[model samples]
Target: MGDEKKRKMLQRIEELMSYGEPTPTIEPSLLKYLDEAALRGILETLERRREKLIEDEKEWLAQFRKEES
Candidate 1:
């Protein structure tokens, strides 16, 4: 992917990440320019990052509970 397209993809991924929920279905218009491989790569990367965020948040909450107790 070109730098500009990559940047836009990353930005959209970040927006999805901030939603703090499962990744929503990407609109076809937004993805029309990318091939299957690029689309898969973006989805996989987003899923991995989202999983990490959930794990980190869980750990943080656990620690907070420990401190409170």
Candidate 2:
């Protein structure tokens, strides 16, 4: 991919990492050398982690509510 496309993907990855818990940390310098497939893989892995975190949070909330009864 072109430099512009890589830059945009980097931005998206950064933005995704900036959100709530269970985020992965990667060095920006290392990311720049990777191809689009690698970048997408990273994004997909992070997305899966985020989904797991959300699921765990929902489970915790449900447990908490159950205990309040």
Top TM-score hit: 2
lDDT of 1: 0.68
TM-scores for all candidates: the values are 0.55, 0.70
Candidate 2 TM-score over all chains jointly: 0.70
Please report, as a residue range, the 10-residue window in candidate 1 with the lowest summed lDDT. Answer: 20-29
Off by over 4 Å in 2: 20-31, 66-69
Q: What is the lDDT of residue 45 in candidate 1?
A: 88
Q: At residue 63, what lDDT does model 1 achieve?
A: 77
